[model samples]
Target: MKTAAAAGEAEFYLEPMIVTAARYDNSAGKPGYYKVDEKKLENGNYDNALDVIKQLPGVTLMARGASGGMNAYSKILLNGSDRYLVIIDGVRSNWNGSSYNDFDFSVLPAGMLESVEVLSSAAGSVYGNAAKGGVIRITTKKAVEGVKTSINLETGSYGREQENILHLGKSGEWSWSVYARKSIMGDYSSARQSIPSYENVENAGIKLTKAWGETADLTLSYSVFSGRYKSKIFNYKNTEPDETKPPKLFKNIFMTDARKTEDNLTLEYERKFSDTENNIVGIYRRSSNAAYDRSLNVERPWLLDLRTEGFFDRYSKQWHPKHTLTGGVEYYKDQVLDYQDLAAKYSDGTVISKAVHLQDSWQLADSVKAVGSLRQDWNSYAGSKLSPALSLEY
Candidate 1:
């Protein structure tokens, strides 16, 4: 870097970067955006994360996999306020009266993640209206100075299962880190047309962070998951099991169970004048859920959703010589209540919610980007949307 800018030292660039706008940084990639590298899993394991996002380039997937199945029902937005602006590390993964309730990459153990920031389209000035079909940002793993660890295992076939992760870290100035993960996905499957299959999945997570002095940082994270997808799934034989046609058989029976839990807490502050750095952050998130239709467990209908969310973000930065600027502004509030019960319903499924938020992302040139988002919503489909987004790079 021109001999470290002539010894004043300031040459930063590294890590498998790949971030299409959304105000870059995204760690690992010092400056030149587009960061990818931590474990290479766009969908190597498959079964979700949109199977590596349908395969990028225009991004589209149909009848491929990951529950977007019955045609398509996956929603991700930013810049507007689709599930409080769908986020990952900053928390909030979509849900506030259903955006199809994204985030079920089977349980996102994707090599414990470290990078993956995809803002597919309609950047809503930066990330709004669920980004239309964008925003899949995830950046995990940080807390370095010393000590690092990793472990993963995989098996195959219908009764297939396996997964394990453990991470430890220590950097300095009293820094600390800890993360844990576990998974078991069995009932790999044993029928396609004759029927009889089961799928069981589980996922877990834990994160802790600490740092004092010079600025300040504290973090706590917890995640939990449960899964149940009974099988007997297959499509074919539009007709023909017949001797007389009246026996033209067709059967569709399968049950499913799901549960999800998430918790997050963050507090950060940074004050530096000379190096030109600014940051103030506070975040709190919580989500609890349950679902079941059992395909028709005697009558179909059982779902409960409870959510609590709060997000406050602020970041500022400036670097000279040539020019480097970072900007941030965010505020989010979420409240939701969902209830459903039916064996033969008449009028009893309802959802009540409330929300308030704002978003901003700017980086004018390093690669070019801009984003703006504002949101206000209340209860069962009230109304409000103003999303803006733009990005340019060559």
Candidate 2:
């Protein structure tokens, strides 16, 4: 009863590459973790992290300002909100002073990143409040065994240009890497003939590592980013124009010109005490200063300068053949060095945050695993909270 076409259809099968699932053995104990590696970065032709994130599913991109213009402020939304946390090499980078705990991705240069990891599911139980939606972790390249250097130059339409340089080297027990990048984009006007918008960004970073015996290692890293942009804001009338007539006149309101600079320094130490036990400690400090100048709204120009310092210690132990236990504690302090307007200055009291977390992973069966986590966080501004989670995987 089988015809020729029917017989061929019975033998059809999917390709091996199409059916095989990619494995992630280095996910740092995160579930549903997806990573974009250097090879994928090369293929994506991405100029920044925001560009790369746009290709990922379940991530919504929100923009403010001109449509498709370089001066736009882009934000990422996961789990239907922008509550996700951004971490750079295990250090929280978001500004806690802001009502919404969000980090600006546009200021970071993609050229300095070695990989990007996204945890699609809720990670609040593990990472704390800012991770109620998800978590994005960015890792930078480390020095290799030998010297490696590269320089890249790119140019395109609309007077867009970018330059990047990277250097990595290792000598004796010391390894170091340095990266620098700059990008500039010319003005572009909207359909309303609003004033054109432009953007310029520069970033530099350095990492140093030292091997201390066979069981321990130390790493130090620092990065600085600066950006300036101009954009026009439009105001529209509520009343609708005549149906047969042309669109109503939209008044050009304020023209905003803004500048921001941020810097981060981190030091980390890792030690493998035994085959089944390891410990890590890290300290980091980040500072950001920004100025917003709006024409026509000259009554008040805004300035903000804030600094945050934090440290974390974590320990992992494989107590049983089928069970692993991990615990960590983190402490951070935030200070508003300057918050000023054209008329008066305001002082924001210091904010402190502390957290302790514990997690256990147990293999229940050959294909079944269980995970449980508990975390307590105390923030000067947000109060204290205890979060717990349990999950099973097969």
Candidate 3:
């Protein structure tokens, strides 16, 4: 019998694998990464994406005001820190460059998400300065071989109602997916203050992909979310004569109205040179607008309008027997179009950033693996910095 080497073929055939759990889908696998797939999302019946994100280990959810839902304040703490990067369909979604602002989840439909991956470890080395705490990646559903559609309608206590629709199909060399969702939260009394609040949200997204020869593909996607809320709060007031008798305080109800809208557009191209090599290039733009009206409490209404645009490229190659190398470049510009508050009108300006990163994964032994990454970033406003990270798994 002839030896397999005599056949003049590669020793082992490359088998494609679908990985939705790892930190980098095509890069080295890291520990402490968790993935919530479509099956889990449906079986859990979560109200929103945030609810599903809360179930992950090392993650804590905190909210204020209207139970952290729409029109309220909510944030996620990963590994004891609230600073983290959020990526939706390969596009950055941070309204504020610093990640300290409230992250609105009302627009993310649980039924439309294909998977949510969380890397709880500090990953600045590969994701840049914004990923000090970790990274949260959300992947929307996409068409496969055939067409599929789903509809979800739900009602809950406090007069909450939600509806979601998803349509996905693949025909010839083109694939497409569309999603729409609406949520209405009726007046509900807060547990602490018994304040009544109402909220409504609307969200929609569409993705289209065109493939050529199974080696290259182009994808375009767009998403929009709008949400508004109204709530009444009691303010205390004291009269001159009231100070004489126990300082009688009068309660005044003030109505507050807040609205927010976000939009994202992205275009990406990917080419596969082989099973072990590939490259991706993409461009994206994201914007968010927020307005708050509280005439009774403040003299002027508050508003914030922010927009960001960026480009990114990444290449992955396996050049050695035990090594896989990945390199990437990123450039982004963040601008505050309009900003105003009770104190003053915050200056409107723009901040730009350019960064490059390299990663190496080594299969040290049969049961041992190591991954190391380094990133250099230059920010127009904050100067430059270098970040490095290393991990070993057995």
Candidate 4:
């Protein structure tokens, strides 16, 4: 008889493990954090991050069209609307500099991720406005102790094909890793066979880490992604239906040919003062350029540039034999440059945001704990706002 581990490996070709922090835990007391590792990602036939996120609890994947096209938009919803924030390797992945504040998961490839953490509660006090709903954090694979390289290829119906390559190694005080992937799909008929749609995506990323002595570590990472999609538009009102056949839809005034490119760079430095004390500083820059071509043959372009820098300091100490105290402070600055109107060039503007937050956790008793957080934010458009949160668990 096959053991549980053997069965899981044979089915998914990866190990199976899940770690969760519930709201009613005794130690740490932090709640609603769930981790999904690489093995869980391979359990399903997932191509993109959205596909894997759909399987998570308390999440709903909503989409409209059968064909994945530029016109179709999908979102991951928690208890409410899709207002969640996405962070990759501690950097905000959502393109807040653009008109659309929501993060698009379709373009995020699943092959590059080593793990995903979902915090299914309001974290506004700690993460600012973007975390009003929740937060989804992604971590990429790190360099292995030994040199290793792997390649993967997959093909499916609708002429879909994908290829990926990854390499990682560690030597002395330096570690490095790189990954790349490309996917393409042939044109396919839409729901009513009224339109044909297709999409192509390519992405690559690299990370380099260096240890400065035993107390300090530094990491630099960069990633680039580009995608293009074409789809036809239909008129819902102008439809013809027959008794034995599906409805015939009228072609709209415009079809869509859209393209987008994103670039992200991040640098992080960390120092450990003690076993329970640490400090971190990070800086990141992201830019996105998008173009849309309508059936009229007119092209419209958009550009979004964003830069963020932040620092955090945390310490944990035991006040008594049975009581523990943890405290931390964080500060960050976000700047966004957006080009709104192209023809007139009059809608160009910049938004600056600065925030600082402090949090403390206290263990009151053997089964009781209290967590408190306070934050202050200053925005160019919205002025200032204060957020506070307090939670008690027993």
Candidate 5:
């Protein structure tokens, strides 16, 4: 990864070192990618983000507890319908929740990431109606010109340990980026965040990108979270924790809590439309949230989330020979308010998950290539689906 005129000059390569092309970490390098970093979830015994996708490849990360209260909601099945899609830069983590916010991935901010891409499927004809079980794009960290900083500290074992983190970048041209993260983990009746159970969180994020002339560019982002957990029906002497299965390894006695807050906003664009290829993005996101479960003390089972998403694309990186083409169009809007705090409360409902997409890819030589896609989902009353797919790469 060189720029700024080949940065530091560390030549030790034969091939494969180039790094950026706007793809970021592509997680496990395609074929169901999995890139998770943060010292691999702070070492020993993970308990969130499905323990880092349960270690990649055809992923699976079922949980009942490990930190964070609440369970069941992460069913990312691709070939069998479950529709999984999450976007940090575009903010679209809605695919019908309950999977505990599907891939909490520790509510993001993995020390201010710079890459995290997981596709799970050739994208089933491209981003349409929640990506039909695949798409996790996260590219954080921008604003660079000078003054860069980062610091992190960690400790292990139950009643685990952690220290604050800070990353800052600045250089003018109206550039700025800031991040702060706090973590507290523990709850191992013998293994993994043991608590009256375990979990403690405080997170913050901010980003700004500028450069108004040249070709065109603008960006702004924000993230905030506050969480406290230990409650899962106060552990109820370790009983039900089913999504598929899991609940035995040394149980946690009892305790309760759940606090939440999530925010997101982004706007971006790039242009170059007349070279060999270029006409990148036009992204947008606005997410809202509020959740509370003070050990069932009150607040009437709170959970409120409002959403918005959109992305327009036209990317082609190859002129001839082996090819590259990413066709895209995606949109989503959701409004949900769930309050079941009992003792008399508020209940609201809203569901409108929409989708429209197209895909293309043809290369026949090089490594071998062929891909196709078409997706449509519009709901005035549940009726729309036309998925076509084929994949090969070797």
Candidate 6:
């Protein structure tokens, strides 16, 4: 009786679709080098480059406070040495500019990074003695095919707040990326502080690139960071009013009023002669200035100024199916303009350095490789030296 109603039944089927992402790892070409995974960096939500560096194997970070805090003084020690090097987008960031100051990792925000590469073992041949302890290479974000924008905001205790914005776009052969960030701590109090401190930081940067087909490209990048902080200040009174009381100097503890500004500018050009050959030329400059007033209600001011300029030319060629050769020449000059200290004698000085290096990588077998490098360096103060290294991987 109901057979007419059961005649209309239908079935549908769907197939699965899979998507994959591609990532590049340049560490294979450099002995003793390792790259932090892109997926891990994206998911870690780290605040600054210092946090990521702290998690690497055979790395130790010694600091006074939090890694990126205003009151923090950090020293990156690798394999028990503090002579490591830091590079950002193919530009050297540290070891050439400041005399008494270390590279403050707090200035480098994590949201603007694309990748981080680390060399834990000695890399003296490729990067000179500055990399004796290790090397940290950082690459900033690049523009994609289309327009994109992102924003991040964070809040925490001690009246901490941070905001970051990044925008990227590409049109035809021109692409650019711009970013800005701000971090503030209105009231930071430590166990050793009787009063709260305040800090403010501002950072902004832009990178522009022009590509001529796939064989050549030119890039210009500039970034600046400004930070101001006032440390905990309180008064200590002599309740017993005696000349023998040693002048109650407790107020001088953690009392600081300082501001610092740092900027970096880099220009780079790359051309590919063929699929197996290429070359790069880069010029970079970096500077830092700081002003401090240690005494409250006093106008005494001290200034510290440092500057560095560098130029480099590098070439790469694949001579055979399994052999690759690379060579480079580098020049750098550093100057200290207005640095002064009572305990340490620091005066105006300029240092010039020149270096030449060559490296070869050979494929010994389907799954084995060998690399060798030699470098000669000339310094204005430290004299000249030759460094050689060899490594094998299977």
**Using lDDT as the measure, which candidate wins?**
3
Maximum-TM-score candidate: 3
Q: Show pairs that collide, candidate 6.
A: none
* lDDT tens per residue, model 1, 186-207: 4433355433434454556666
Model 6, span 1-394: residue lDDT tens: 5476576666678799899988664444544556776567789978777788788765787753322222334676776777677777777777542334357666666766788777643444555557667777788876779998888899998888988888889999999999888888876566878455667888898999999999998999999988887643334444455787666544433456778788999999999999999998999998877766656533344567788899999889999978988889999988877774322346588999999999887877655678888888899998998888887866
Give candidate 1's error at residue 262 in angstroms: 4.1
- Candidate 6 Cα deviation (angstroms), residue 184: 1.0
Q: Can you write out model 3's per-residue Cα lDDT over 30-139, one digit (the tens) per residue? A: 35567888777889877677787788877788654333212354667776777777777666676534543456665676766789888644445555566656788888
Taking all chains together, the TM-score of candidate 3 against the true structure is 0.80
Q: Which stretches of candidate 1 lie over 4 Å from their true place?
A: 1-145, 152-160, 174-182, 185-210, 213-217, 220-226, 231-283, 309-336, 343-394
Query: CA shift at 260, candidate 1, in angstroms?
Result: 4.1
Candidate with more favorable, higher lDDT: 1 or 6:
6
Sequence-dependent TM-score of model 5: 0.29
Q: For model 3, what is the alpha-carbon lDDT of residue 42? A: 82
Runs of candidate 2 exceeding 4 Å displacement: 1-31, 42-44, 64-73, 97-100, 106-112, 120-122, 189-195, 233-252, 318-323, 340-345, 362-369, 392-394
For model 4, residues 60-119, the per-residue Cα lDDT tens digits are: 776532222323346557656566778777666774433345566655566666777776
TM per model? 0.30, 0.78, 0.80, 0.74, 0.29, 0.79
Off by over 4 Å in 5: 1-145, 154-160, 171-174, 178-182, 187-197, 200-204, 211-219, 224-228, 231-254, 257-261, 266-302, 306-336, 345-394
Instruction: Give candidate 5's error at residue 390 in angstroms.
Output: 69
Model 6, C-alpha of 64: deviation from truth (Å) = 5.8
Whole-model lDDT values for every prediction: 0.48, 0.74, 0.76, 0.64, 0.56, 0.74
Candidate 1: global Cα-lDDT? 0.48
What RMSD does model 1 have?
21.2
Ranking by TM-score: 3, 6, 2, 4, 1, 5
Q: Model 5 over residues 1-394: C-alpha lDDT tens digits?
A: 5597779667775865676566443224334446666555455344334445545554554443434323423344433444576665544544344444454565454445655566656654555444555676666666566766666667887666656555666665667677666777666664554336566777676777776545555776766666676555422233656747775544444345566556665666666555556555656655545454544344345455555555556455555644556555555555555544334445455555555565666667544556666666666446666666777754
lDDT of 1 at 66: 23
lDDT of 3: 0.76
Candidate RMSDs in order: 21.2, 9.3, 9.8, 10.8, 21.4, 6.2
